[model samples]
Target: MDLPAPDRLAEVLRQRFGLDAFRPGQQAAIEALFAHRRLLCIQPTGYGKSLLYQLPATLLPGLTLVISPLLALVRDQVGQLGARFDIPAASINSDQDDDENARAMAGATEGRVKILFVSPERLDNLEAWRFLLGLPIDLVVVDEAHCISTWGHDFRPSYRQIVRAVRTLAERRPSVRVLGLTATANARTEADIARQLAPDEATPLRVMRAAMDRPNLSLATVEAAGAPAKLAWLERFVAQSPGNGVLYCATRDQTAIVAGYLAQRGLEVAAYHAGLDPAAKRRLQREFLDGRWRAIAATNALGMGIDKSDLRFIVHVDVPGSITAYYQEVGRAGRDGLPARGVLLYDPADRRIQTHFIRSAQPTPEDFERVLAVIAPDADGAWPNLTRIRVRSGLHPTRVTVVLAELREQGHVEKVLIDRKQVYRRVQGTDTPLDLTRYTRQDAVRRAELDAMIRYAEGAVPCLMQALRRALGDDDAPACGRCDRCAPPAWADLPPVEANEGVAGWLLHRDVEIAGSRRPPMSAGLALLDGQLRAPPFIDFMRRRTQPGASLAPAVIDLLRRQLDALARRHTFEAVLPLPSRTWAQRDAVAALAAEHLGVPWGADALAWRDAPDARQGELLNNDQRRQNVRGRMGAALPGATEGALLLLDDYVGSGATLAEAARAVRVAGHGGDVVPLTIAKVRWRLGARGIV
Candidate 1:
């Protein structure tokens, strides 16, 4: 490896980035990469770690590929590097349309783009892997590299394959340089990252770690007994705080609850979480960065390599999962070297939420079998592509991959490359019984982690900051006199409200979101499905009511009428338009009864079912099949005006196809009514205690 001249490197650094020199560990990282050594750099946040690779990316030849975890991080890096340093950069992410991503791929392929930011998920995506295999990648930088380790606080199974990607890239670029960078990682996590990123028969990865302390941050823990008290402390923090800050929540619901609380108190606040729409996330991120909003109540999703330097305070509504997570989140504040506070509103009850998460993350033997049951063999007794298996399994690709990986480890399944695609097949001549003993052990590991976090939150004798530093392998770390344990704490008293548990009854009167229904092209807002259609009585009711000589009992009829009436009261529908029927042809009797009960006129002729072969929408699988089954099946009846404040009613809704088609019909007829969809039972997935979930 030929190194760049000292003067040349200086000129490139100064002229390109308008910088004089490197941060403490940056130059060494860049030099290590240039030497074709696998590098692991664990520097603190805002340490100009991007320059370690970004500068070299400009001077080096071919493409410098950067794999980042979040779309926001990708956009931020690309935008900054391209604008400030005059480097041609492009990124491929889900936020971009296919054509836009293709253009980015083209730029990388043509060697016009010096650096390309990509999603870590792309490493496992076969199509994306094929595209990258063509590019002569000189350097591969894995940002937020801690995620690569299962022991890592923010472990993602998708990130573990990045080293495999690096090894593949080495086939094209014989001396491809790989660099793993993160802000917070314990010694164990750092070693795991280095081990994962190191290729077979190569020199071990070199670890470069820096101090983990942030002296500017004053840490505190307030014992706000429960959720309501946490919100109460949050109100004062946002109100009294000078500059913009972030309120971190353990879940999306918590973000909404806290953000709503602050917003009602006349503060400009927004919620950022995984559940938010991409456009909404982008908007809130931009506004908060531009200092438009006073604060953002967000889940762990908000702050990453995001460059917000002037944050005044960091508040945690609940205990974080680990010390790494706690340190990383609090490190977000006071990056400008000004004084700021990191406050945790401690509550013991919050441990249950995290414990539940830790338990749920580890899949059971049943999960493995569920995925395996969907696997089909070809004529010669081989399996089909993963996409087919994934479709049949109805699981997320990441989760399916995890289960498959576990099965492979257990020697229950094998992945043989069939025509260049890895198709999985059950191991021949083996008894693959469901064994869940390993997951229990893994669960213990997570439980121990949670317990340690709880100890830190409790602040028993040791300072919270010191406990974090010690956990992250920092020895001789003196007390900074900046924590509640080391110094007198602030905000000892805050108004408390009784913590409410369970679902609120008023939630039934409210409409939540069903954004990506299996039935496509339907505008996406509706009341939550209080229960699943498959639940005992409802399933039995569906069978009996759809029978030829059946009539819905009066009690059942009244119960459904109440549900529709509650929804109708919310939307104030003036008329009821019963969807076209299949089981009971022309007799939407129960729907008419419900409309009469609500004092809304029924539109029998508003839309009629087109004569077609009998097909039950519930029996269909996947959105494509359901959409094809419902297409053009319902249209406005001839010589009838479909206009009013209308409520669409159906006996039972399963893929929502019939209701979707009827709604389309109502719109096509130019109905002047507000169309509110109501149903007796809905096919729901992952129903929670909160009906809206």
Candidate 2:
């Protein structure tokens, strides 16, 4: 159990990795590892954190086990590292082919692989642990190590098992070194890592923290009147920002809609979400990293394992559910230490959405009861077929396992492995069915966490860096002086708009009352006409123009002239183009108007609107009912708005209706400014271009 020489590690780094010097905090962390002391490295993004452990693995004798939270990263690291070093490296994950896994295990047994990357779930395999116990292991590195903490953005219950597994491994090989690595680790997460990895010995843990400051990243946020305003802000911000970036949407559908909107605007963008095929996601990632695309609109799935160092911006189109998530996502920006940006487009309504998300996440006592019931009986009167237990319990698989873990901790259940699957059995004749009622306190804690997250989203406090510090319980810390709030007010201010002179009289074309068929060109034509005609005049004309048993056709050139004149005065109008509007003269005219006045051109092939089926329309309307419960819960902390026009934005309008309705609510809620409702995408215009019907 001799310690590795420091010069040998340096030589490995130079010869194998072609490096000269350790980054800021890497040397101290590497020294601790060489001395066999437990260490945690809290380095910021793009600081070569991986090399801190990877370099040491090369110097240390025997196999180095790398526990990673992400399979993709493990595979990528093994692929990259194996090419440079003759010492073998292998990763085992669910994605690996059987032959590949067999080869990896063979390499491990042959003492050829210096590093073995595996997901935490793989460690649950008793046979794998048993086999690894026989190996001369030098170090165990936990990648994305923050996931070990319950407070982390991505907490996996399986990670808790690592403590016990490490203890077991230590008994077999008592001199193994343990190291943890992360890009972001607040105080809470750091303590959690220490407790899990080096709980007993005084000063067994050595923590090295790199400064969190990213001076090149400019943070900004837009507080909208409602959803529509947020969408409008996103449109404006993305249009102004330079280079490739990512827009994080809250849902898969929103990702698609935002990406579609940007694409329609002639920007090269792509969408990535769980809904896409894995191959498609890989392609999108490659394209985005290669600069073939200027932007990507995706859900949170886009960030992990995405190692592009030069991503210039990361925009959260919807506020995330937690500060940890927000920090991790925003931290993706400016990784190259060049000027970059992180923008959050938020509105009061977003809190309600997040609240619902949290409420839905509550794991009930019944979930625990069912899991115990399934694992109570097996051929050995033990838990077997864990996957079956998960499926039959009707609980989220992760939740089921978490509850099982709690039961095991309480000494109410025992777990063993038969083959590759987990086997669990309840303590025979134990009447108490894992009483999770005690977890009621945890619920309150979770509620407080949600409240904190909501505050982070809605707080008017300007300094994002300070806000983050406060949220992470580092209050009274000095301000970072680098975030949007700390920046000069003028630099962060929205462009000035003329008072009450809202996008001009473009509201005088004929109001065509649409019915039945869903056609994009027809819908666009209708919106154009509606925009041209004043609301009252349009409604009146629609009522008067409908003739019994007759097609509503009017070849009135004067009507178009009047609409054009109105548009010229204020640049606001609504109209309906005919089907196949590409050939319609008025369609081209509207396209020109949109390009010249509104800063968005109407594409001939773009979808103007979609008609939701009855079921979907009902769902869209139902969302309003759901929203009503949380509508009045938000209170503004900022001073009353100064007299000006305010535009609201949202990602999509399923009924092509909710934005204006929500805008009216915002106005009534004491927004003193003139309100304009907008959306990135509109759907179902058949009811009316502006939802008047």
Candidate 3:
């Protein structure tokens, strides 16, 4: 492989990429690839790392295979390559139809495709793997390559398989070159990535990292007491900011909460997260890019592959899990070498959200066995549907996914497509023991990273940007002198921004419609995080007021009373029935309040437990066990031929399995009207005996 002449490289750069000259380090990285050297490039977010491979594929002899971790990023890049640069590129991903994927494959085989983008998960498919191995691959690019190392903030299990694929390619053609790229890798993470991406043990990966100091950006950390104060400051800041921006939230629910609050206050904003449909996400991204929306309130799902250059601001409503994640997110600002600002509305309580995420990611060994047990093979030795496994095992869908990925990576299980859908099968006679040592090590590393992030937020150093750059392995990074610490902003010591009373009240008392199992069709509850990232007040409310003999707190009763008053405006209820529970006093209190609020009769003893055990519903692992525990054990004693909608009240709703059984009992007893559920909170995941919502 020969390096392109300097003149020829400039000619292609100008004509194909619409650029006059290469950014610093771009040419060097391209040269390393041309010489068939394994390289790892670490630069800031706006750096043109893509051109290192995209430009080379134009002059190279063979295909450039880009293995990325994000489906949205691959789709976005593939579209840009052909539309913007006139490069013949295609992508093969699960999001595409069979015809689309087949066309991509066929195009690659016919030598019409110069660059092919595929996701890391695609390598797990045997057919896709063999097809890639058969291609005439000259350059292999691993975008977001830090995901290959557990030490990285966003580690993906599928990325670890790329080395095997690259090794196979090099075994056939010694000219195959590998390039690994990331924007957020500390010294330790960089070493891990370099070690994993090397072609062989004797070969060292050529590391190329530009200076990470961004002088045009100003960094500041503002202290807010809680969510309400944070929301207040966010509202005031975003309202006064001049240009387009992004507001980062730690959870999907927070995205909606923050976005809705801003939108109600006359800001053109929308929420973006993984839960959104593809069409909505596409529309929102297009609108944001076109400057039709002022800002996007989003989770980290919007981080990688966003190419907007003129974003004026980036705000964090909650603390991120690590300094790497925080730096990567804030780097989205000041891309155009213009003065831009990044602010963190920090509260000590924000750390709870990141802590919850770390705890949830670590599944116990028993969780692995429970998930494995449900993946039984049929007569043909094919595994069952994963949806069934999730329901049967009663674990969170994400937990099941992690367990399966680990099982497959360790060679205890194998994945294959049956009728274009993925199914797993156990490796014959291979009893691979669970190795949890890695989980322990990873947990310790994550906690330490979080602690470092907290220290950074609390001003452990004099310069914010300098501290961030140093954390990302740039020891020589000088102080920017424009941040709050370097040159304190005028408002650095100002009092907390006061919020609109109505907005503050709404923030603390928003309502949610919980998905129900049957009959009710829908349920209602107070705002609470779906997972473990809940406020201490919410945890205390659920624990203290839902005890065996406790009653709803006065504030809780008032909140529920106000919630029902709003629900009354939507639909009319004939009577109120408290769902059967061992906490009789609380149920009675709620029934009295609801009955009084609606001016309707209380269906006392309308639902009674027959012979169900005393085990709590949250203690059960899966829907199957929970449903069976309550099935046929509750009898409804409603008036004969009862009519009209009935309000079913409970303390909380997790799986809604118990509620479904109660609804069935009501139907079986000749009630022939709607049954709407109302509760204090709606849980996203199953609550442990002492865990938060």
Candidate 4:
């Protein structure tokens, strides 16, 4: 590979990228790639890391296959490459149609496309591998390369296969150049990335580290004890701020909650998460970039591919799992070198949410074995269907995907397309033991990262930027004189936020949709149990002491009445039936109250448990297990309700299998009426929880 002369490089930079000169470390990184050395470039956000590959792809002879993590990032890069520079670039991802992906691959094979971006998950596909094998791949760029390392805060199992893919590609194209780029990589993460990218010491990897301190952004943590207080702070803060910003939340539900509070306050804000459809996410991103939105309350899903530079603030309603995530996310702000602020609304209990995220991501040995047991080949010498594996293993679809990928990587399983359907097949005579040590170490690293984040949020570190820099492997980073520790910002001195009726209503009255319902079950409360942020006290009070005729709290009764009124407006109800529960005695009382409130007959014995469930719904690990636990275990006592709908009520809905089973029982009893499932509280989790359809 001939290195482009400085004059030609300058000409290409001027003509194609419209840049006079490279950013501080960009030229060196580009030169290293041309020198055919394995490269890992760790620079802060907004440092133009994309230029390293974009420029090289322009000059490189063969295809530059960029393995990106997020589809948004891939699309943004491809768009910029084509629109700004008129570069022949394209991307293949899940978001794209099959025909589009096919054209992109065809373009690469025909040597028309210079840069082709794809996700690591896309690389895992056998069809994609065949396409890649045929292309004359010159460069492999691992964007957001920190994900390839287990030591990184956001380690993805799919990324682990990229190294092998690159190695295989190298076998055909021996002169292939590799570059790994990311904004956040600590010492361990960087080392892991280097080791994984360049396993053989013969071709040494070059490390380029740039100064990561950002002085234009102010950092601080404000103590907001509860959801109401935090929300009040957000409301006041957003009103005072001028430019578009991002309010980061821990979960998808919180995004809606925070965005609702802000929007209700007459601010133009929208919530963003992975749960939203692809088009919705794209619309939000485009609108935010077009300066149509004042702010966006989003999860980390909105972190990548965001190019807006005038963001004035970045607020965290919940503490992120690590300093790496915090720095990368907050780094999105002040990219235009203007004054911006990043604030973490601090509360100690928020750590529980982060802890749960860490634990859930690391599947246990039992989880692996359960998935393994289901993937064993059938008598016809074929593996079970993917859906069968999911059902028989009793793992959530997402978990099954992760475990299957890991199993494939460990050589215990492989994906083969049969009858145009992708399914996992057991590797014959493979006796590879589960890599428990690696899993254990990864869990430790994640927990430690969470602890570091907590310490930073608690103000244990004197200089916020210095702490962040050191956490990202900068040991000798000097303190930014503009931080709160050095110079407390004016906003830090604001008075305590007072909770108002709006905040109280947003916290208390917001209903949770029982997810995975055929009719989308309605719930009056967020959860029957209280967490650090959500506190619907009415639920707690009623669950503790409620008999068949117990008087209900006004808040609880008001909420139930409101839900019932809404249902009545939509459809008439003939009877209210309490889904039978052996443990919780409050369901009949709650249902009876609901029936009385709605002026409907209370059928206390309409639903009966044929036998006691082996365990509570919450005790079950996955959807299939929960469904099986209640299957054929409930019998309905409903007399033929020929005219109006039947209101089936429960105190709490968690996997939602119990209510579904009970509804099925009523339907099986030949009741020709709509059975609407309603619950007092709907269970929500940050991870490892999904609804059963």
Candidate 5:
């Protein structure tokens, strides 16, 4: 397999893309792309990874399919390709509308789209895979290919599955070349990535790698005593800096804090994180790029898709988990071959946060079993579908997908199509138990990597660049001699930690008021979750507390007691009326016990359910369905008016329909005075005429 003659490829590059040359290794990559080569390209950032396949697709007759990890990346690459060659370029992602996705697929089918971007997770859809099989796809590029390696710091299991889709496509279209591109990969990660991308290919893979060193970039580590001092130093750093930059944070909360600090100091800045709605993210990204803001404080979510050539700096408020991830984040800087600085500010305590994140990512065995238990076998003993099972089980759809994938790999389950929807069930008679030891093994490896990252931040070696390179297993990586380690900055000594460096603790100080209704005001759980069933200690606590003969956690009891004491002190409640449980025995209801502790007389039957539905509250998606779940399902008994507010209590208050209806019942029963409502946990509750659920 060979590319179209050099003249032909060169002509398309010049005439269509307005470019007559390929950067260093890009030409070899483009030639490989045309040769149907099984290629692994470990190029540095801004080396034009997108153009490798984009250029070859123009010379080919069929579609060049791309599996990218993020929607932003797909959008940017597609936009660039369209602008350069003026061809039909489209992408399908989770965020796109049905018609949009259909149009993209239609373009591919009609041979109008030369390049199509797809989310890596699309491989999970058998139907989508089958549909893509009909297209004349000559090249499949797994962009951000490092994500396929579990050992890689940015590992995504979905990216690992793209290999299967590539293999299937290769089976149908034998000449379909597979190209995996990533800016960050060490020797170990590179091997792992290569093995995962085209494991079944008969042709041996060729790897194209550019030098890892970026000469114009400088690195520094700042040791701030604490949070307040850190904020002060951050303001100082930006004040003294020359051009616009991005400050990387490990979490969105940190981003807000840092962004606010800089804004308060009269610096133009904005916060960006993944939690924001798509429009907000897009707006902030554009604003910063357009030079409206001096800096944008963000989490790693801003790293991959952005392609600013002259981004003078990339600073980190907290240490990242691995050298690979750190390199990728800093690579955004100095893309125009000018000097840029990557600074890391940290306290020794910051390591704990990264450790917590690494630990939290590994799911427990209980999580697996809890999700699997919800999918009941259907008639003829077939496995149940996941969509219907989601409503029954209060878990995120992603969590379910991850768990199912794990189960399938363990040989404990199999997937089948029932009426065109994907379903899963236990593999018959094999009775293989689910294994979670691999997660434990991975956790150990990640912890070691975190230690390595900590060492890098601590400046364990003289040169930061060389230290990072060595940590990533780049033995030949040279010392840049341009970073702070080579020559310290002018203001090296940061201010000491402020006495009150941390923010003040948040107190349980608020009173819940429901307007336009006669219901008692409410108290609820510390946080609200999307109305869905999640595993224990969430659902586990719920079931144990609501059911008879099940004991409660000491922490749950303590939290309820603290809330009750706080509310009593705030409102000076005299009498307590407990919302009646669906059953007489709600062993977990702490309202009765807490009121007794407060020496306030309590009645368990003050509010009663009036023939509620059997379905649990977790099955509902939003406030509307939630209100219906407990509508007209409760009645409140009347009590004489008292000076202090009366307390109406339930173990868990969801949607407030039961409580609101009970308040109506109490009003109808001729009780007056402010009705106070309290629940051990406040689940999602919709207030009337407002969308605060």
Candidate 6:
């Protein structure tokens, strides 16, 4: 099957679209598509992934079905395609009006639309599938195809339904060419796509990848001293960098807070998240794109369909769960082949926040089984329609929808929609009850997958790229030179410190006290104090007490615990604990007490020692040691470096002592540099203050 040449595609590209030439990797993908084979194209951002399907949509006869994960993306593509070409392109999603939808369906049936954009959820409708069956689909393109894979960073349950629809379409039209397009697809995603789409044992699928590297983007990371320090650093970074940038926060509330903070600092900014209304989001996006706004503070929801190419910077106030997500988000910058910066401000405590998020969404085996039992009481009996099932199951409509989808994939049930809602009917059609045990077993498998994902997130391995490779079944793969660990800056290479040398003892003591004395873990205040003492004689004192013959005073422990409790109650410190755990609450009390009484200037030596080669080594250094190191280094390098004028950067601040200490060290270093400790972002210490959740 000889395909057309680059010049031929180029000729078509110009004649129809008035483009000079195909973007890098565009011609190759189009040629592959012309061969009438399934194609997987992995091109970087701004490489014109849409043209791979759009160009073909023009040349190939009949309609082109483009499956997209996002409604905004579909709308954008449709609008762009409709602008130049006379061909009809319509997006069918939940947001469309009834009349618009009817028109779209009619156009598709009449073979009037060249490209029909739809969300995977649209395929859940049996009517839509039947309608699609009537049309002649020249090519079926799945955009953001990585979402179809469970191993992908951003997995949507609805995306799994795509396989079923593809299978249905294949049965109706065997010659339809399937094209999966994505800007980022690692090995796991590629394999998952192939397994779902082309499962024949004899017909193995091949994944074609474009280059992943983008030379224009410069990546950097900074170790936050504490919360205040991190925020301060971010503020300075944004002030120094170009205006067109995005600051990505991990949570919706954080997005708003960061945006507000930046706005207060005299920068024109807006916050964006799924929590906002569609109109507001669109307005904010437009404002930012049109240069009316200088920056945006957003959660993960902002980037999927965003086409802004002149973005100059991207800052992550919190660490992303995986490198894949990090790369995709940061890849939004430097798309125009212009120099841009991708900065990550990180803190060790932020891990707790991410872990909580992961746990919240993890559906247990029990949950799955419960959902299945509601959907399929009698596997052999006729499945009830979606409305009846929804009413009978007593589960939320969304969950019911997902469970039916799972059943369909397992071949235990089939789905059809009556009046727009999905209905799951038993496939076997025997009058026997479904074996609930089978669902339970499947639930266990899903639970294991969730566990693996959590373990992958929490793994201590420094190489993120290697971890991803291993997860994808490539254990011996080389490191991705683009990750934080592989290309760490020279500043990240500090000397190692002993575990017993720094704040470990204080932290252990606080942990033990919180476990024994406090009803809940120590509050944020207590944790701050515990962190502070860990940098000093407290660590040495704990080590001495641990010796076989050493006698420790119970009174001191009691005093520390009381101090921690008071600080927590006073709301001087903030502490976070996930549900199903009480130990953190107890530790919080101890930490609060230590924070109140242990007020001392942190040494620069402590700061440097804490930022040691190994994370464990750094945790061992005392606050004073870190402060001393910072002062010594800065004093020698900067003429005006002084304790009062030095700036310390941290990711989060439960109590402000760490920042205070960093400031004190600058003053003590004999230089006039003001020690201004700043946090990249901060959470509310008081539960009732605002945005605590």
- The worst-scoring run of ten residues by lDDT in candidate 2 lies at 514-523
**Tens-digit lDDT track for model 3 on 547-593?**
66676666667778887887777667888888877754477877887
Q: Name the regions of candidate 1 deviating beyond 4 angstroms.
A: 377-399, 408-441, 489-519, 524-693
**In candidate 3, how many Å is residue 53 off?**
1.8
Candidate 4 at residue 424, lDDT? 85
Which prediction has more favorable lDDT, 2 or 5?
5
Q: List residue ranges in candidate 3 displaced over 4 A.
A: 94-112, 365-399, 416-421, 428-435, 490-501, 511-617, 622-681, 687-692
lDDT of 5: 0.70
Best by TM-score, which number? 4
TM-score of each: 0.77, 0.66, 0.79, 0.83, 0.72, 0.61
| TM-score ranking, high to low | 4, 3, 1, 5, 2, 6
Considering summed lDDT, which 10 consecutive residues are worst modelled in model 5? Answer: 504-513
Question: What lDDT does each candidate get?
Answer: 0.71, 0.60, 0.79, 0.79, 0.70, 0.58
Off by over 4 Å in 5: 199-202, 365-367, 378-401, 416-420, 431-437, 489-693
* TM-score for predicted model 5 compared with the true structure: 0.72
lDDT of 6 at 130: 73
Cα deviation in Å at residue 455, candidate 5?
1.0
TM-score of 4: 0.83
RMSD of each: 6.6, 15.2, 5.8, 5.1, 10.1, 17.6
Tens digits of per-residue lDDT, candidate 4, 126-237, equal 7887788888888899988999887888888788779888889878888899999999998888888888888387766888988789878988888887788898888888
Please list all clashing residue pairs in model 1, or write none if there are none: 644-673
**Count of clashes in candidate 4:** 0
